[model samples]
Target: MKNQFDQKWLDEVAVVALGCSLPGSYPSREALLDAAIGAIEAGDLKVVGRSSWWASAAWPDPTAPAYRNGVVLVETPLPASEILARLHRIETHFGRVRIDSNAPRTLDLDLIAQGRTVTEVGLVLPHPRAHERLFVMGPLAEISPEWRHPVSGRTAADLAAAATVGSDAAPDIAKT
Candidate 1:
């Protein structure tokens, strides 16, 4: 029999992005993250764990306000597309308006991955470029160091240390 059967448990894990630079309706990024987590918990998924919120200078424009970013692991039976849809809805509720490529937003939620599903035509798995960003990989590594990239088979910790983007990213010491 094939070994490493524990990997099967990851099938139900859905990774979520908690990123925000604008306060919007909330008083602070922490409040926004809290509200987003509450909304997520109200969905079909069950929030299981989370990573430390990391701070990074805004991308494409370092002069802009820094961003607070983190990840959450949820257990769900929902498919990748459905999970993405739900995340978008939560973003809408948080007053996120899509304009510029990486404009500051109250909340930005992305379904980084759901289990090991991978697709190119629709919602891409492993978030396509997430592995190259420290902001994403770092937090993910904090929670699931061994989270494997379905395509490359690399662990999150490895990816985080090797990330090409957000070199200044680090776990927010004040928040953590």
Candidate 2:
């Protein structure tokens, strides 16, 4: 029998990394992380790696509360759009209300990458800003040191290193 498969709904497995951060008082940093992990686990995403929490860099607002940031790597069968939607759902569950860009949020979940697939219209693959933010690169490098940017071909470690060199604004990452 010939293989029967639907190209439109085929499961596209991808190694996805999510950059999570929170700058709020309602849900503690640990609580936010636990909730995220719970959501990921509920979604049946296989947890491959995790990074230590770090303080957020002062961006868009230097006076904002110190944001705790981290990254999680998961092996998922969901497409990029579904993965992004799931992340948004989790954020909503955690009281994240998107009112403005760069606003102090209770939860911020960014879909940093989805394997090597590149799409720019609705969702940009290999996140456009991942290469520049140490907050994202630091944790990403810890979990996926060998992972390369699909567009730039630079390893996560390299990107993290570049983000830190001569940049006084780099986030202070604390080793836990």
Candidate 3:
């Protein structure tokens, strides 16, 4: 029996912004990123574009290992729920465990947005907290500066700029 979330829709396109990070000891950033790309490819998601890694903002713990963050843009026909499910599966594939709300892990994949869709039950499109996180906005701005918040109508770059104010975490783009 196929999972309900696995059911496919036809010709739907979603502009997905994914924020990826790895905390604690694990595979090299390059390796983990490669794995993510591989997983997206295997899932038949079209790679629209991606941004270079950036230093992650310290949240919940400022002393944790520096995290490398980046965003990927994909065109997928999957529903918002299934897209989120796929993201969780990718996280699990990279050894993520749900120990706590913001615990460090080998991989963290967030589904930042699914076009204009929005829901708070199982998954939230345009991510409920995305507008306030530099980690999400920075890379997202790099690739999709014009991308607007569904609710606030603020562009990704605008959100990123606003988030930088008074932020102790100075995120720098990773040199590839």
> Which candidate number would show the highest lDDT if scored against the true structure?
1
**Per-model C-alpha lDDT, please?**
0.83, 0.64, 0.64
- For candidate 3, lDDT tens digit of each residue in 1-176? 11111112211235444433463244576567656777877875776667666665456676765666667766776677887788789878777889887666677777777666655486666667778877777776776677777778887789988984225433453445
Q: Estimate the overall C-alpha local distance difference test score of candidate 2.
A: 0.64
Top-scoring candidate (TM-score):
1
**TM-score against truth, every candidate:** 0.92, 0.79, 0.80
- How do these models rank on TM-score, best leading? 1, 3, 2
Range of the 10 consecutive residues with the lowest summed lDDT in candidate 3: 1-10
Residues 1-176, model 1: lDDT tens digits? 11121456666588887899988878889778888999999979898878778999999898888899998888887777778888999999889999996888889988778787665466678788888999998888887888887778898889999999998999998987
Residue 30 lDDT in candidate 1: 79
Candidate 3 accuracy as lDDT: 0.64
